[model samples]
Target chain A: MANDKVTLAHGAGGKVSQELMEQVILPAYGNPVLNTLHDGALVEMKGEVAFTTDSYVVQPLFFAGGNIGKLAVCGTVNDLSMTGAIPRYLSVGMIIEEGFPIKDLQTIVSTMKKMADEAGVVIATGDTKVVEKGKADGIFINTAGIGDKIPGTHISPENVKPGMKVILSGYIGDHAAAIMAGRHNINLPASVQTDCAPLNKMTKAMLEAVPDIAVMRDPTRGGVAAVLNEIAEASKCGILIDEDEIPIHAEVQGVCDMLGFDPLYLANEGKCVAFVPAESADKVLKAMRTSPYGQEARVIGEVTAEAPGTVGLRTGIGGIRVVDMPLGNIVPRIC
Target chain B: MANDKVTLAHGAGGKVSQELMEQVILPAYGNPVLNTLHDGALVEMKGEVAFTTDSYVVQPLFFAGGNIGKLAVCGTVNDLSMTGAIPRYLSVGMIIEEGFPIKDLQTIVSTMKKMADEAGVVIATGDTKVVEKGKADGIFINTAGIGDKIPGTHISPENVKPGMKVILSGYIGDHAAAIMAGRHNINLPASVQTDCAPLNKMTKAMLEAVPDIAVMRDPTRGGVAAVLNEIAEASKCGILIDEDEIPIHAEVQGVCDMLGFDPLYLANEGKCVAFVPAESADKVLKAMRTSPYGQEARVIGEVTAEAPGTVGLRTGIGGIRVVDMPLGNIVPRIC
Candidate 1:
């Protein structure tokens, strides 16, 4: 506890490890189930549950809106929500580099607790391992979550069909731009912050309003382009989008243009693209707009019967161009 | 796919990411639930369930008997089993250092699948991320598991009371000895390999044969000494063990003695310590001995009313010595 930086002993599963758990971790995320300190947490669960896991290795650790801790929690929460489940429990596995600041760890953990509280999930169980200095970056977090599946809802790429409306919850490339700016020391407008927020509430509301929604995916790493291409291939349907309708913050657009980065392939941490039946598009969009995270939700595209298994973009000049799945790393560790 | 080494593109959430999933991961872990390829996997659950997570950063990814991948899966499964649960599902999250061999990745993943199959659990969901070279160790694996709690069993340290017998599943410290030997380039007998096998079946048998088992804990990170100390504190009872009765392989004992290590403080990947009523201890031990993983099961100690919240070791020299909780790193990354 006296040391400001983590040491190998802190992860040696000895007295120091217990001190870290009791002092640093338990205070932030302890609940009755987790406080038991059993090898695993015991909780009552029934029916169907959705399970998901994600590892956060985002660089800079902190960016405009959130840190790796917040992303770790929200990313798993959104993944469960996208599966039509109410996010419930999460397990955190942290790999910390020796000599890393304990203060930074505390900040990250507190941020994680805040996000977990907002997403209505408990940090049920966790483990931490510290690697020798230089063997790892600052810190990498892996979060696995369990959520109760919403009844009467079937959300999957298999449900995606021709004629379904494609909804973009908000602007793209903000997360990537924020991270790039931080890494390159490029000054940006105050408005060009990372769009990192939990989308569980918004997605839950949309699902409640329309349980028959085909599919919902948070375009995090490969951006919307990858999501669209996967859906198209899985559903055996073509996806066509209007370039004018795909929302991009003006500053974010400028950053992308300046860097020769295609916004379509850039990551967005807090956005989701939902495929809804034509009849339910308006209702689902309205439901999404009711939440702050989705206030800018728009119908950016539609599933098409032609050109099955491909995505196309209708440009401003009234010409259509193929939108390819991102081929390689545009930006590594963007989240 | 053409690259022999994993690149940043594999974790870019783009086409290469998909290829990694379909070509490498899916082929190894494909199941009905995981094949859905949604944001999460939907699994059926009923009643009380146990959830746990552990991150494996073991050095020398491959050690005697198993590699980190096998350790990743078996560790979680054993944790769930130690909670008197029937392990069912696991979520794997991997962080690979850039330039890590794809062949090694494939070998590790296939070993994971093999171990999961042996444990009768499914790899339900997973995530992968790649960091720049030198930013991470060769690879780190995080596994989170879910299991159904065995009905009518109250496995908790609080249930551990005075007069309860302490049962150790098998010989201690083989795992640590093997790892230490590998790291220090010390030769070891072939029989002194890591005892990193899934203990679900063995524990399940014990629990079924004796439903009133008080507590169960796998002596993983901090080894049996830490486990006993924690149990003593949590149960508010003193634990007294006979050092002569504690089982340790001859070669492992020699290695520990030569290296100034105590087998009591050495880690075990596939061992558990259980607390049970005196009347049930024999039956539980009998059940444990029926499994290959627990062939050396022994009643090495007992709970005592005197010196509550402490552990005492009765040495062969006719003197009782206090067994302190491990205070520092004995072996780093020994998982």
Candidate 2:
């Protein structure tokens, strides 16, 4: 269990990490699904399955509003939900450095169990390994999942059309700014909290409301700008996003300005960008705003035919700016 | 995507690592199985499936006999083989450090695909992440897999009873000595190449010859000593082994003596410790000795109900010594 500190034997995959599992991780969430001791979990369920896996190697494992455990659960669950799958089962594999603190591990794992139960995804199977101190940071998590992929509901980037409107799910860049402040201990006028929560419910609601939604993407690592260019390229179309209509929280905007960062490039975990038909844009926004996660949703962009394979931004200076692909990493390990 | 020298952007899980996948890892072995992005690779057959996952994080990712890629494939396939599952599909998730060299990345990935083909397991899905330079040694791989669990075959530790003979499939400690020498530049009088190779064929042959093999374990980490003790505790039986009967290469023994290390505690990448009923021990040994991985198989010990939960070693001096469980780590990260 890589809690706070790390030792070398943890990565050895020997008795040290095995004991940590028997004593720490296993006992806290003991159930029949976990005791089978199989490699990847074997789950018997009653619906079409959607499986996804994500690896989390976040720096400063314990962050401001959430840790890697919470991120692991939410990240994979959201992937399932984006496809309108009812998130069902999850398998967690943790690699920790030896000599980590026991208390810190407890806090992170307890948080994970709570968050998973809230998301209606059961923790079915798990694996624990400890690496030598220098071999790892603090702790890293990789979660693979099995969910019921919705029947006959397929939404791909190729589905985007010329007059589709893009919806910004919530305030942008809050997760990125929160992490930066926590790591550097930066003082700010207002508290900055990470927008790290399970987005499955919000995603399912959106899918139910608008079954024809096209190109659903979580603006995570490279943020909205990176994904916008990717969606445009994939659909062979153009995206024209409004500058002022895009929503940003005050604290996040202040941090971006102070740090020479752009809200467009900063990461956001709990939010998503969805492209839908122009006629239903208002109705979709109304449905999104009713959900807890999409309270700040807005129609911020539209698909265009004039400039295919590119994304253009309407700037505050009354000029158009091409929102090209992110040149390099904007924020490291923000997820 | 563990390039020779890692860069910080790899850990970002964005563009840099994505390029690493497209250029280095994926192109080296692009196939239809890999194009399907699944969590654990799905192996379709006429019946049930077997699931497996293993993480590889070896220091100095490239080595003399083989690199971490070979180890990852061979190790996980061997695990599936031990469970009597015809090893089939594998998923590799690589966590690479920033500043790693591209040349080394190409070498490791090419070897990985080649070895996967030879072992008869397809690389179905893969993921790549880059960490900052200090976060990891070079690269760490997490592999998850699924295989078709064969019907009408039951193998477990509970089958071990009094009078079962222990069969060691090959020499001990060669891999351990080779790694220590190569990593630390120990100029001992030994060209001790590691005994690392795929063992699925050999295991398959042996299982066919002796269908009721009691227990089978790959003595990779913590070597023969750990497996011996684990079987003793699990089956509630004692193991009486003649130390002289155990096979060890001359070079490995020489290195073990100079370093004040017990050969029993050292790791071995290509070896197996099996328990079979006395009636089938000879048949199993003959079956194993016919294969590349188990050509030097030998009978080393016998199970006894007296002095349960303990392993007793018969010394060359005609004295008996009790072997205790290891307290400190011996050769951490030997995987």
lDDT, candidate 1, at B313: 99
Docking class of 2: acceptable
Instruction: Give the distance in Å from residue B150's predicted Cα in candidate 2 to where it truly belongs.
Output: 2.7
lDDT of 1 by residue, B23-140 (tens): 8999999999898888899999888989999999998899889899989999999999999999999999999999999999999999999999999999999999999999999999
What would the DockQ be for model 2? 0.28
Least accurate stretch of 10 residues (summed lDDT) in model 2 chain A? Answer: A38-47
Model 2 chain B: weakest 10-residue lDDT segment is B37-46
> What lDDT score belongs to each candidate, Candidate 1 first?
0.93, 0.75
Top candidate by lDDT: 1
- Predictions: Cα RMSD each: 0.8, 3.9
